[model samples]
Each structure stands twice: as structure tokens, then as C-alpha cells.
Target chain A: MQSENLISPGFADPVFQSQAAFRALLTALSEPGLIQQVAPGFAAPEGLEPATAIALLTLADYETPIWLPAALRDGPAGAWLRFHCGAALVEEPAQASFAVIDGAAEAPLLADFNPGTDQFPDRSTTVLVQCAGLAGGDIVTLSGPGIAGSRDIAPIGLRPGFWAEFSANAELYPLGVDLILSQGEAVLGLPRSTQIVEVR
Target chain B: MTIHQSIPGEDTKPAYNYAYLDEQTKRMIRRALLKAVAVPGYQVPFGSREMPLARGWGTGGIQITAAIIGPDDKLKVIDQGADDTTNAVSIRRFFERTADATTTEMTEDATIIQTRHRIPEAPLTSGQIMVYQVPQPEPLRKLEPRELETRKMHAWAEYGLMQVKLYENIARFGEVTTTYDYPVSVNGRYVMAPSPIPKFDNPKMHMSPSLQLFGAGREKRIYAVPPHTSVRSLDFEDHPFRIQSWAEPCGLCGAKDSYLDEVVTDDQGGRMFVCSDSHYCETRREQGHRGTMLADASASGLVEAKS
Candidate 1:
């Protein structure tokens, strides 16, 4: 195995950049929707990409069960996550609080997972969706709990079908999964409560 | 100055637990807890430090229990309020090793209760503090991404966005459909996340005598609501805050008012409503509140009941 194949590998060595990524995730979640640059580490598996690795490093713990895409389930990614984060592999999406949907086109139906109950929306699963490109481009009107006014930044190569599935998810409101779209080294947040309206 | 060394080889006891989080971490958690008691339904952010346990686990609750625990204190931990649940058992075991605190399944006997999902069925007294393990601390983060912007919104008391979201829910669902973790406005100040406890537990926060503390170790934030403080669930007058209700009482203890967990009994889809708080239900049964069939079963000596 390559030296970089480890999820966090030696990044937990208390280096400047690894601490920076950890702090970035902490701040992003604390503030919400706020983008913080993370110096990416770990060699991502074929379909399960670099951004997914970043998220796996930041959030995965022994207590959290990770739901993997079928293709990546028994692959190097599974071994890497287990060895590095000690995360359990969950068979069902609903049982997993954190899910890695590599090649999200093949990802399972979002409704099948826990969107959380009405009073406890945070219990809903947070999915890390891997995409081919994830750069901010065109504007999409976004209004919900987090937006002061509508704002837009297009994540790259995310299928229009993804948006449709997400909007269907929005119909559930307090009971919808939150999303993390990652392309290459970039990641963007799409909490379930966010209302995304296509401008174009 | 002469360099000092141990006179002979001896096993040294580490001052703090594995993560350098000492009893003082629990003490600091306890102090925050007391302040939360003094004010009700308020999000009082504390300087939450990292724990050896992972962030999502009951780090916040553990810290609080550690701080408030003395030699005499009895602790209880529940995930979904079941004492025997795996996570609950693990948390109780953690305290037994670290703090050496006596553990209890009963809510009445517990000085500190750390919970996820459900609060205890029995109402807690002023003497107890409930520590909630929070995954996210910012209520406005869902509204605004920038901390700088959200802080301003909070300072200005701008909760119009939250209201708009709820209004939309009503508009869409024809009902205010939020069933659990409904957002709440605390002390007429901050719109706070009540740590994902069901809406059934929301009303329990209103001017309650017991203190409530929320901790998010992963998020590195702490907030509190002291006893006797005002906590209003975020809802319009037209769409008032409501708790989940069921026509039936608990299967085990005949508890009428307690939050119930729906269990699927058969493959054909028979469901049963059991008390979410096993300890509270057991206590109630001991005090004699048996369901129609249950009381008869007990009377007939068909089943033995344990409190």
C-alpha cells in the first residue's frame, strides 16, 4: 500500500496543515455553509475521492457507522476507513449517521435513510456525495434556515437529477438528509433544511 | 537546583484521565451546569474542550457528570433513555472506571442524567441537571453560514428567518409537521437547538426547576438553560407548539404521560407502545400503575414485577 493510502495516516502527527483541516471542519459546522479551505491529505480510492477522505478524516469515529457505496464497500477505502477512523460499516443507510455515497449516481434512495424526526432534525444522516468536479460557478437561489437572502454557487458535475432528488428530500423538511458534495479537494455543504431553487 | 527523580521504581497514577481531561473538566462542566440551572432555557456557551472519547459520543454528558459528581453522587446515562442500551451501558461503564461514580438506572436516584433522543419520563427535581450531547450548537447555522453574520443576527434578535421556515412548513404540510427537535427561542434572546430531544420534551424546559446543559464536543461549544428560565418553542400563535400524543398508555408500566417508543412486535406489523424511559416505567410499576391486562396478570401471579 502507498504511504498516502492511510485516511489520516501521519496527519494526526499534530502538523500545521492537518490541524488546519480539523479546524476548518469545526468552524464550517459551527457557523454553517461557511467555506473554509482544507489542505487535502490521503490518497482517495478510485471512485471514493479525495474530498471524501477529508470528510472521513474529520468526522468518522468508532461510534459512527459509515454506509459505503456498494462498489467501495469491500475495497481499499473500506479497509482504510476501518483501520484509520475505526468506523463501523453499516449495511443500511438509515442505521448510518454518516454515509459515504461514492459515485452518488448509484447512491440509494435518500428517503430510505433517517431524515430525523420533526423535533430532532439533527439526528438525520449526513451524506458525503462524491462528484467529478465541485467548483463554484453559476448561481442557484438558496433560501432556508441558513440564508439571509438567496445566494448561489454551482457545484461542478452534480447531476440535475441530484437536485430533483434533493428537492424531493426538502419536502420532508425536518426529516431529510444533509449533504456534503465533494469534488477533488473541494467540499460544499447542503444541509437538508436549505431550500435550493434553480435560477436558470 | 538538583534534578529530582523517583527514589525507587514505583507505578505512578496519572493525574487525569486518558485525554488529559481531569475531574476538573467535569467540575467546569458542573459549574456551567449550575449556571444553566440559575437561568432556564438559555443557550450559555461554555469553553468546551476536547475529550478522549470521540466527539459524537456522550463527551459533553460525561464531562458534566464528572464535574458534578462527588463521592456520593449516583449517575445515569441513556441513549433514547434506555439504561441497558449499548451506548448507555458503555457510557455508564466509562464513568465507573474514570470517576468511580455509583451508577443507577432510576431517574429519581440519579443526581446527573445524560441523555440522547429522549428525556426521562419522571420530571426531574431542582437538585438534578440533565446534560444533553449536542451534535450541532448553532441554531442559526441552518439559517446563515457565516458565523460573523449569524452572530449579528443573534445580537439583533433577527429570528424572522426561523419563523419563515416554520411558516413554510405550515403552508406546505397544512400542519406544523416538526415532530422532534423543534427549534426554540430561549430567554427571548437566542434561537437555540434543544439538543435533538423530541418536541415532547420541549415543554418540559419551560421554567423547570432542574438545570439543562447542552454540550457539543465535536463542535466545541456549550450552552445552558438555568432553572426557572423562559423557553419558548419557535412557533407562530396560529401554529402553536405541540407535543406528540398517543391514545394508549405504556405497555410495561401503564404510564399515560410518558413519551412512548413504538416497537414492532410481529412480521405482520403489530406495534406496541412502550415507555421510552425503562427506569421511569419500572419505578411507576413499583408504585402501582398497571395497565388493564397487566394489573390482572400481576394479580393472577402469572407474571412477577420488579421495580
Candidate 2:
């Protein structure tokens, strides 16, 4: 057997692990900028964090096509996700229901992904960006639904124009892509309803 | 313990998937839930599954609970704010068997509380999630029967018809007669139906610290209100939104702040009001809170000595 063929195992108990992971993700999204950790009982493949792997396994399926950046697409992470989640790998971000971007690398413009339509905003893509860490970066203020008055988040290793692209995406209110930042085992959510103030 | 309908629980644990739902179905609902949370008050259409229960009886809430619940979670189910009601107990029992999960009647102890037609009297914290069984997810559907037009209304934030509906109610009944399922604008964007929960519970959702999820199985839609989001009930400037209040306190727990239901005690047209939230009422009674009816019962020798 090839070295890559022996991919790391997914959740031990698919029922509990996925349910628990989904709850954690829900908590993160429901309270924007709140970091939540879920142990999906699986090791991460190359170039992907454990949180990313847990998210893909819990959410992605054949129906939800996923678009990965070049590094993840070419690496073992792609095969791992394809094997574990059975999610269709798409080259174009527009065709993807979910997309994963490496924050350390050059990320594509937020416009590249689907912003859904004015009628059905739920069709918008959910972008998951793998970051360096959940903290120790430029602090940004978030306000909107899900947040109380305001929330401050500082996730490391997002590209320079990332916030600008996110701001442009926010301009499209109920039609923007939701972002999730995963670092190590911590995941912070920034849904489209959340407004990004500045990286101060 | 009585079975109202055929809620045949599959005793064979190994045969069925966890929580009586397959992983694929869970993931599908999970995706819809994420979208629902992302866009507050927007009814996101999803693939509604056929559950063991009937479609009209909280299948959407059950599916949402099944999708989100884990073994470690303490599930709580309520119908009309009563924990011991047929619908509430059955659903709670179903989850207990299928998920092998512990169930709690107390609001504070539960991680996820599934409800039909009422929000708990107790304040919900940020850690807890409230799943509402919504028969109708679209607030504009009743006024405008056309689906496309309603979608356009939501898309354009055109809620003139809703105001007209309330206005018509005022013109006919001297007040907005919509006692339950009152419409509210979530985050100032989309108007959402907060299930059939009495307008008394409507104020509980505004800027609430707890996450709220609404599911309609027949409508095949899911919507959400994230914690601390603005949920403003629709009403005219003169006709402000007001909750139902009673002059008398509860007969069971002496609760004046809780929503009350009138119960007729005699055929002579005599009635007494009691707290609708069974768990809250029971806890209060246990704490030696006496009420008008409790004193009467004690005087009549109907009260238990222990209580």
C-alpha cells in the first residue's frame, strides 16, 4: 500500500463526534468571534488543522461540493477529505457550496466564491480559512447579529487584503459568504451577518 | 407512559443510526442550520425528513434536536410550557431512548430545549439553545399566499402587507388580535414568525442572550436568531406591542411574572389561573411558595403532607 493510501481515520463514533462537532460549530457561529474547540478524534492530514478536518467531516458530504486552494488540493488533505467526507472536489470556487482557503498563502478574492442570490441567501458558500493561530494578531471589532454590542477577535496569518475582501463581501448583506477561521483545535466563526470594523 | 399515537421506538439499538437519524441526513440539516444562523430570520429551505412522529407534531424540532444533540447533552422538551404534556413527554422519551441521553425538566440544566408554542418562563443563558417547532416559518405566507411574492417581499424587505394585516385586525377587533405567533423583524432585515408561541413570549426573543432555532417540517424551512440579535415585534406607533397580563397571580406557584393559562375547576363556570411553565411552577412550589389554590387545597385536605 502507498504511504498516502493509509489516510488518518476520521471520527471514532461518527454519531457522537459529528453531533458534538456540529454543536461546537453552531456555538461558534451563533456567537461570532467566539472560539470553540471540538475533538473529532481524528488526526489532521498535511496542510490542514484538526479543526478543519473536524468541520469537513461534520458538514461536508457529496451534496456539498468543496473547493480547496491549490496547496490543499494537491496535498494529502484533498484525498483525506474526499475519502472521509465524500465531498466533491471542485476547482472553481463559484461551484462550491463550501471552500477552504489557507490563510498563510495567497487567498482568492471573496468575490470568487458564490454570494448566493438576493432571494435565497442560504445558497451562499461558507469559506473556511485555516489560520496560524486563533489569537496574537491584529484585533478587529465585530458587531451585528450574533454579537452583543461588539466582539474583538485576533486570528493570526490572514493575507493582507483579506479584511478588505471581507469588507467588500459584507457589503452584500444577506448574500455574502460566511467565514470560519480554524487554527490548531480552535475555530472562530464570522458569518456574513457579522460586520468587521478594522484590524487595529 | 401512554402512547397517543404510534411512536414505535426501535428497541434494537444497533440497527438504527444515532439519534434515529442517519449521518447524511444530519449533515444536510446541519448545513441548513448553519445557513439559518448566518442569515438571521431568513427562512432557509431544507430537505425535511420523515420522522417517527407525524408531520404536524414537531417533526422539524425533533429533526433539529436530533441533528444537534449528543449523548452528553441534557435534552428538555416542552409543549405549551408544560413538561408533563403528552407531546412534551413523548418527544422527551423518544430522545431518551434513541440518543441514550439524559433528560431534564429544568430549564437551567438543559443544553438544548425543544419547545412547541411557548418559551420557558425562566431566562435562558448563552450556553443553551432553544429549538422551536414552527408549523409556519413564513410570516408573510398568511397575508400573501403566493410563494414567489413572499420571497420577493423578504428579499426587498417589503412588509407593508404585514402592517396592513395588523391594521385590519385593529380595525375589526379594536386591537391587534394576533395573540400568538406574532411576527418580528430579526436584525432589522427579515420578518420571522416566532412559531405559535403566544405574543407573551415574543419579547423573550429580543436581544436574548440565548440562541433560538425555528424549524418547520411541512414547510421544509429552518430559520434562526443568534444570541443578542434584535427581534422587534411589528406594531404601529400608537399600537405598541404588549404582552398578555393577568390581574390575578398563578394558583399553583403564586407566579405573577409567568404566562398563565385559565383552568375551569367546576361546572358552575368557576375557573382559576395557573402558571403554564410546569417546571418553573413545580420548583417554586417545592420552595414553599403558597398560592390561592394551594391554600384552598390544604384547607380542603386535598394537599399532600410532603408538599
Which fraction of the native contacts appears in each prediction? Answer: 0.00, 0.88
Candidate 1 at B201: error in angstroms? 0.9
Candidate 2 deviant stretches above 4 angstroms: B1-14, B295-304
All models, RMSD in angstroms: 19.4, 3.4
Q: What does candidate 1's lDDT look like per residue over B1-307, in tens digits?
A: 1112222353364334422344334334433443233222334455577766777887766665554454456788899979999889988887776555688988888877888877887888855767788887777787788877865675566789888888888999987887777888765556888888889999888766666778777666666665445678988787788889989988877888899889897899888888888888878877987754354666677878544
Residue A7 C-alpha lDDT in model 1:
50
lDDT (C-alpha) at residue B237 in model 2: 96
How accurate locally is residue B15 in candidate 2, as Cα lDDT from 0 to 100? 52
| Candidate 2, residue B185: how far the Cα is off, in Å | 0.3
lDDT of 1 by residue, A24-122 (tens): 443233222445566755566655667677667555667568898776778778877788667898889999878877533645877767876543344
Compared with the true structure, all predictions reach lDDT values of 0.66, 0.89
* Model 1 CA deviation exceeding 4 Å by range: A1-200, B1-20, B23-47, B292-307
Question: Measured by C-alpha RMSD in angstroms, how accurate is candidate 1?
Answer: 19.4
Candidate 2 structure lDDT: 0.89
Output the worst ten-in-a-row residue range by lDDT, candidate 2 chain A.
Answer: A39-48
Q: Interface RMSD (Å), each candidate?
A: 14.4, 4.8
- Per-prediction DockQ comes to 0.01, 0.64
Q: Which candidate tops DockQ?
A: 2
Per-prediction TM-score to the true structure, in the order listed = 0.54, 0.95
